[model samples]
Target chain A: MSRTEAHPEPPALAPGEVRTRWIVSTPPILFLSLFFLAPFLIVLLASFQYPGEFGGLAPLLAQGDSPDHGLTWENYQFFFSDTLFAEIFLKSFLVAALSTLLCLVMAYPVAWLIARSPKGRRDLLVLLVILPFASNFLIRVYAWMIILGPQQALAQGVNWVLSALGQEPVNLLFSPFAVLVGMVYVHLPFMILPLATNLEKHDPLWLDAARDLGATSWQRFWRVTWPLSLPGVFAGSALVFIPVLGMFAIPDILGGTRDMLIGNLIKDQFLGVRDWPFGATLSILLTLAVLGLAGLATWAGKPRRGHD
Target chain B: MTRPSPWLLLAAGLVYAFLYLPLAIVVAYSFNDSRLNAEWVGFTLDWYRTLFNDGEMLLAARNSLLIAFTASLSATVLGTLAGMAMHRYRFRFLPFLVITPVAMPEILLGVSLLVFFLQALHLTLGMVSVILAHITFSIGFVAIVVRVRLHGLDEKIFEAARDLGATPWQTFRWVTFPLILPAMAAGMLMAFALSLDDFVITFFTAGVGVSTLPLQIYSMIKIAVTPEVNAVSTLLMLLTLVLVIAASRLDKTFMKGAA
Candidate 1:
């Protein structure tokens, strides 16, 4: 009844001819168990415990006197207890949503452009999308730091113009806008990849047919192109949204110390507050959220474009 | 069909601009002579020399390269087997489960793995722990890549090999193995790149002074950005750009050979 029933053969693989199905898959099965499943299980168990000192956990069944004491919902309660915590949860979701939206807007056109290009150009564009991701993410974020720093050229230009107009130069770094800019910068490629893959598979003949039938370009897009591209949009959104939801580095570097997201909250619990149990609880909550989103995406993936 | 709307092309150009400009700035600023990043002084390579001379930075780079090499090798092996199994057999939801490590927020993976090692296994956190952690997350990337490559392979070839009285071992060695080798290598390279660039998971698993290049860069930036950080970052970007181009070339050659 376990989910990982190792390689139950379908009717296709004749059972007698094979040595055994499970034998071949055992290495990967064991690898996933020892590394992934076991660690996740530990986190789950730890999440049920009381917060002990310095990244330690009290026994899950231990006794408690106060709300913050042993083996209580206290840790979980405390995390979601305040309005600020709730605000952070909502804010993280909103930021991810907006970021995904912005990525969609920027990426769809680019993905479409790449898909429609000739082989040489298309490969070049896709390479452009991928080459950046191969570099360090922190380095890229740090790039944004200097670019938007008050003393940087762009900011200095703004200040020069502002001084002429007798207005003060604006602080750009460590703001919500800067966070959005960084999120869009980092996540754009993720959005582009899926959408481009889907678009590349689309037959240009569909567009030709619609045009020959006297449909306007806009009508053709709305009637056929948009519907056909929903799967890509869905896939891209899922990819972009999930990561942006748990984004720590961007918010930390760009959003400043004032605006806290769920990742920062979780990081604080472990490193700053030293509440291992509460941090574990938050991790579990995020895992569930991730799974839920993935499930929703899978369910919605009807592949109605008729291309599977 | 309608020439892709000039607007789309413009947008694509802008997207590329957005992606590369920050990186270009880093590369440009690495040559900046002034310690202050605000204004450019005369061009100089002093920062590059500084980064080269920093013993700790080089050690971290060496550590990262070693760990990435080993982790990617193990990941390639695990991924190849998993891809073959998924291709040969049917397991509903297996693909979904396999991708969870990659799809789940990396922070969760880092935190959970850290807790597992420290609290549950009581394993010492160092290069070994970091390598194990890298292999764990990277397996999914390799598996997905190898699986996609395997999907394009013709199953009839396997049947033909079998019909010729080749044993399963021979079929795999001569037929399957040769065909998927490029993909496996690409997967490994990608895993290598991912391991090299990882920060969040490495941050958690690499305990007690075991710093990778990204961790080294992170620490450096956490205090303040210096010319050395810029120089080192530009070098990382250059390395990655080279790796990606090399991997893509391999992929293209594989496609040509397949065709």
Candidate 2:
């Protein structure tokens, strides 16, 4: 037997355990507290601050002519009163939901195939799925510009085929459809990876058991495979959905400037209009929404200790 | 296992094609001698030559490498520490705090940072801001990877080392570090790739005068598409391919060792 196997088990409360744990955690805790937590706190505080007349933050405690004087809901009030903010928020959610749905549809089949493929070929297929992500994201989205453009080879070929069939050429680019395509294309791998990981854990015996119990293939899948894979499905969906909500470049590039999402609005607030406080408020709200969704997913996915 | 279905294979093949065809077209057009992004005339290496010769593209590439290297390295270090903490210790709010970045949208993070930097901090948009922002997101990924690795580890080894009079730091360096090195490497590589590919966050935080390859590509696309950009992209893709292969190989080796 190896030395490791020969050794007796150690007690849980070993000496130096507390110190070691503290040492292990301190660096990351320090880094995150300073960089991630602090900056976010700053933004959260900025969000609550009132906006100056010139669109800057006034001092919170001091009453002044500046916009950032004590606590006020003026920025959020502005967001609520404006129809554009609501429209943009709803549109962003729709885009994210549709994108997540599309990714689920697209990724499931690909992941299933990958999981079932011969071991020799599986790695290569997985590699292909991951390869596109390595390229510049904006450039890959730009590639669609060529594919979906009027003179794009695919479009031209389609146009030719349509003319032969007595149909008119279609303008498919620069639409919500195009944005959905881009989002799915970009995020499919995120969906696939988590799904594949979960699916790979599933034993074939479960299916065999179902079959032996006189279940049809569809029934076996719906009862066994689907339930088993819910964790991954939720995870992958959240992964794709959350990012799609914040997506700016995909819609901006593919759907064009006309289809502005909330991300674009936030960007416009900061850079275009130079409204930092309002932008901060939008960001905080969006962050809260994401946190809420994530919390829901976790609650749903949490395993019952005794049941499993 | 069931027999392989032909329909399933065909569907997978079509999806792969859909995913790759646009990219393949860009690569093919990079070699075309045509001035227009569309309508390939013939194959030529001129675009690559132009890409290499263009000072702005080269500078952008250099900046991208610099930012990715620095940000990813820092994220790896911090993430490893965080992962070790989560794995070794049970703390209240640990999971919640660790998962916050994962759940938060990149856009909100980006804009928030942009707002903080511009308004509150009064920091200029430059390499420092970009690196800080990249590290913020990349560290979470690295921590997750390392956390997985740590979960699979045997605790007895560390206990034995400590019993043998090794200090906590020594126990980690001699016992824990080597075991988790593969995950560290994977996390670092992922961090680098993410930093290199980051557009949205970088776009917001990267104030005036600082440009990485993705930022450069974004600006260039806003104006027009060029074969030179495609060539640069092809090169970036190849580089990413190499790094991913290396990281995956390391990961497989580590998995094998663990198994």
Candidate 3:
């Protein structure tokens, strides 16, 4: 069952095996280094440089050794000097956290149901959760736009209730509520799958023991099941929270004019404002933020999962 | 297992409805006689007819197919190598290179590649750039699928092949290759599907005048709310559904890797 035993390393190395290892490993290592690793490094380098006269990054080595030859700390300083950028970062975290919370709330019951289902039906139930997600991402968001459009039944019903309550009618399509709904809808299955996998591993005998001791149903859940499921919750939250931070399409399609997140800001820099250095700066910051959060999640969940 | 309580059943049913109602409405409204998606009108095939006749849309479809084909083909070969290397060797850096793309925020990949292509390589953004970008992210998925397949295989078979005087290449050709063929097929299909359905990455890399199906759909939806968009979406959904289901059938582990 151990990894080494299952695929044992040879005690002695063969000449052909060494050659084969180098040959097999070289292509992907080279390809990823060039296309994947090199690009991020370039982004970091570009962050220190100036924006080109036309658009993209200014040439790193222009004319002479002049100070204006496309290098400065202006991008990072700009990000720090303005509180607006920090506020947007905070807003993105807030949105991502809220979406993760909503996904957990919606997914828990479904996951629990699947976990407690007959063994033969678990795969079918899990597949049912994943089926909607298999459709194109844009199509999922577009579906919500239709449902939340002004003339749609849901919007009309909400407006009628608002009128009866002496409040103004609200447009549902281009709003924060629409963005959150789209996010939760898109990410709910991620929460469900991990949670179901975890919950399915629980021993029914634990619950039976608690029940035999005259424990109430509520006590059994609160004192036993809920506490046992925290690891799954953390795993699912990380899955939902990280992606929601970088999402732009949902906000672009479903949000109001004022609903821009870090993603839209980074996007606008390159595509709209034509500031490559600033965009690269924001991207590097986001990467750092993601890595920090991922590290924190690992540190926090380390004891619960009992290993690295 | 205990039966689900009635409240649990109701909550789960609502979630299921939340998932499916939007897609059902889209398909139904695609067939509506009217242009508006707000209400269901009479049935008609006008939208499908319109989609077929739209020359620009057809061009985008062609581009998407071409990109998916080329990207998935190359990714499958590279990914199989990466997977085998990870399984058979103890390289520290290879796992990082192979897995980071699959794990990182996709927009980061998209923007970084945009910078790399435009600023470093100074290559004009076009079909070739888009295909390269697709291959970059897709190698990870295919690697994961191949790795999972290899894990389920018995190591004894390869040892037996080697003991019988088969060389490493011969062992791979006669033993490992046949065993992992289904997983490779599943990986390739998954890659093809990912490439075809990609939007955020393609959005940054496609540049001006180059369009894929998702890019084309995005522009159309932004400009208008027509049944034509819904028709195309339903068709795209059906196509992806078939591809994913087929991949799952070829390898059950595809479900795990994909999720």
Candidate 4:
């Protein structure tokens, strides 16, 4: 439902009702303003301030002699000045795109099957999709560590195949391959659930009508089902894509020396190198990137949605 | 309705297999006698025994439980209020504030909270900070669940309570509270699970010396490889499984809220 539609019209409040409404709403408003909204503003401010001599940020206000002790656009400048940072941003975008695509491909068949299944079993199927996701996120990543460990069966089997093919044995863990696997494994449900929800709403009569017109199954799917499912694909992609873009843990745990992404770079700034300004700058840019892409997606989807 | 194609069934089956195989391996290997997660040597309870005895792991678990309990309890109360507020009155910022945290990439929340605690609040990164971060994120989830519950309900019942001699507080305490109890329960469980499983935000906000199960698990996964990690993972999965089942029983749509 549209948010405006959800709200309807606000009624005039009685005096006591006004107080009751305030009482009901104030606690959360105050709490979120203090913690949620304030922190974001703080991070925005932190991004401009200079790094302290020791660690964290320098003073917000200028000291007696040193204007350099206060704010500067140095953090943002450093981001734009360095090709390394740009490359990491590009790499993260590529990883997010690839993960979304992979999730889409893997999720489509499962979503289609679930939608076409007996109505009695759809909830159970959805639950099955969500079951793995409900487990700890780190545990899910660690599962891959076990699976792709050098001495594990999957790796050993692959290396054996490589050796027989006259190639050197390849390490599976601590590789881009491992990171992609982790990303897809963790995010697949995000794609599946939305896709299934959309697919479940499709009118079977449309497909049947096409079939009766002597359309091939491939034609029916390509022309009808695929076109109708794009909205679902877009929703699922946004859910998978945004988080994957900022994901540090998957890459941190699964990637090798060469496979650093934006999340890792930002994390390194704060936890690793103790540079708060740079970290805050990266975070702000990432937030901007997410918002920009989301705005673009909504704009792109508008015409298609209007067509439907 | 016609049946799904055998080919489609096979494809979906493979996807399901892909999803479960890794987790199944972890569970299977937790009991393996080998020190490494490589191959099965023999069955032993030694890893679980090791997990029980490890002081750090035990403390982390205790901290996690405490944080989850405190955070979820507070979140449920605040979230119920937020939900009711949103349902009753139209607001520009309330829904935005509540929902954005749920929608935003979690790392952003973690990083911002880290910045806030260190710089703005001048607070130490420890259990209190971690709990606050947990509550901040979890409130949105609890609110969503409670809102969904409120949406299905008929307003006439509350109106009827007011038609009688019931005051606003009496109506809320006697009528509204009982009606939304299941949702409140479901929301609390959802929050508990979220706070317990949280890693990214807790990692940023937990500072030094305050370890949750996830932080402990992350270090163990990164620095050391032992069947003990597997044991802990298995137990965590089991705990989540129970919570999910309990939450779903309380409210079936909790699964949807969770997703």
Complex DockQ per candidate: 0.53, 0.54, 0.73, 0.73
**What's the distance in Å from true for residue A60, model 4?**
2.1
Q: How big is the positional error of residue A18 in model 4, measured in Å on the Cα after superposition?
A: 0.8
| RMSD vs true structure, all candidates | 3.9, 3.9, 1.8, 1.7
In candidate 1, stretches whose alpha carbon ends up further than 4 angstroms from where it belongs are A1-20, A61-71, A159-168, A209-216, A305-308, B252-259
Cα lDDT tens digits for candidate 1, B32-94: 998977777889999999999999999999999999999999999987777777667666545
Q: Name the runs in model 4 displaced over 4 angstroms.
A: A1-10, A64-67, A300-307
Error of 3 at A23 (Å): 1.3
Residue ranges of candidate 3 with Cα displaced over 4 Å: A1-6, A62-67, A303-308
**lDDT, candidates in the order shown:** 0.82, 0.80, 0.90, 0.90
True contacts kept of each: 0.68, 0.67, 0.73, 0.75
Shift of residue A1 alpha carbon in model 2, Å: 31
Name model 2 segments beyond 4 Å from true: A1-20, A53-55, A61-68, A118-120, A157-170, A212-214, A302-308, B253-259
Q: Against the true structure, whose lDDT is highest? A: 4
Better of 3 and 4 by lDDT: 4
What clash count does candidate 3 reach?
A: 0
In the range B83-186, model 3's lDDT, one tens digit per residue, is 99888887878888998888778888999999999888989999989999999999999998998889988888988888899988998999999999999999
What digit string (tens of lDDT, one per residue) describes model 2 on residues B1-259? 8975787778878888988988998888889998778787988999999888989988988998999999999999988888777665666555555667656777877876776777667888899999988998888788878877776677767777977999877888888889999899988988898899899889988988599999888888888777887888888888888887777787763322111
Candidate 4 whole-model C-alpha lDDT, 0 to 1: 0.90
Q: Rank by lDDT, descending?
A: 4, 3, 1, 2
| lDDT digits (tens) for residues A101-210 of candidate 4 | 99999999999988998876987898889789999999999999989999888899999999999999999999999999999999999999988988899989989999
Better of 1 and 3 by DockQ: 3
Candidate 4 is graded, for docking, as medium
